[model samples]
Target: ATASLASQGTANIWSCASCHGDKGEGTQTVPRLAGLAPAYLAKQLHDFSKGTRISDSMAYVAKSLSETQITELANYYGAMSSPSGAQPALKGDLARGEKLALSGDYSKNVPACFTCHGTSGIGVGAQFPGLAAQQPAYIAHQLAMWAGGARHNSPLGLMAGIGKALSDEDRRAVADYLASL
Candidate 1:
């Protein structure tokens, strides 16, 4: 259903490939689309449409699309193979990351990463993202954005709160571990 509409062609605002590139390799600013999971792609589209992600470029591009079109676009990009991403690195210590991801700081009463991210960093209900294979740079950027209230895509507004709870060392640890995964 999504494929039929997406590949049919571009719309008035912008063709899906305009920024993502013909094959979804993404530009310097735009992120790669091809090879991304359909689930992740759908969440991003929904976030942009709902004003949660709040990117002027993305919102502008998204405005012309219908809800069905959004789903189709997301599905189109998500279904791609040969996803573009950097190789994971594991230099930072992971003990703290393990604590945050698995049990959190029980003494600090911090919540487990699995509460929102699921057991394997694969995300869960709603629009949470899968963290398994993302690049460390992107992960740190996203986390910082959440902590600073810069990213509005988080529906529950929990990212800022959660991000604030983490120390810099913890963030690095998690990013490193995520790359390793």
Candidate 2:
């Protein structure tokens, strides 16, 4: 499993490490997979393969894997320790971002991200994902995708509505703040 995850095969499949890094630390556009819930990871792989999530690269790679492989990969990454060294990818108002993340704008029906994502944004089981130390570019891109209806994998359109309610500046702020965590 380590070999497969670290090296690409001859069958046109890109190794997970090629993009996500050996320890699943991820890059500017990619997201860290290490320490994610096994269930969440498996669901994402399934979603990518089924088009419930939209990502050309992920979809293609996920489509090539069997269910067993997906589960194995998920388990492997889920049990691994999260790596450090994430950096911010955007500039924004940190104070405003903190307010949004902790209290939100109730007038706009925006719930605090921490309400569902946990106090530190380390995620809530398989339901919400960890936002701490993630790539700001990845976070901002996902928000944009949800806002534009290009991504709809979040349960009950939760993220879609939240994304739509956030202004471009808000998105950047939140992304930057989360990366700081």
Per-residue lDDT tens digits for candidate 2, residues 8-41, read 5436678998889988888988998888888999
* Candidate 1 clashing pairs, residues 3+ apart or interchain: 35-80
How far off is model 2, as Cα RMSD? Answer: 1.3
- Over 3-37, each residue of candidate 1 has an lDDT whose tens digit, in order, gives 53343445455566655667776543356567566
Query: So what's the TM-score on candidate 1?
Result: 0.69
Clashes of each: 1, 0
Candidate 1 displacement at residue 136 in angstroms: 1.9
TM-score of every model versus the real structure: 0.69, 0.95
Backbone clashes in model 2, listed as residue pairs: none
The clash tally of candidate 1 reads 1
**Candidate 2: worst 10 consecutive residues by lDDT?**
1-10
Give stretches of model 2 more than 4 Å off.
none
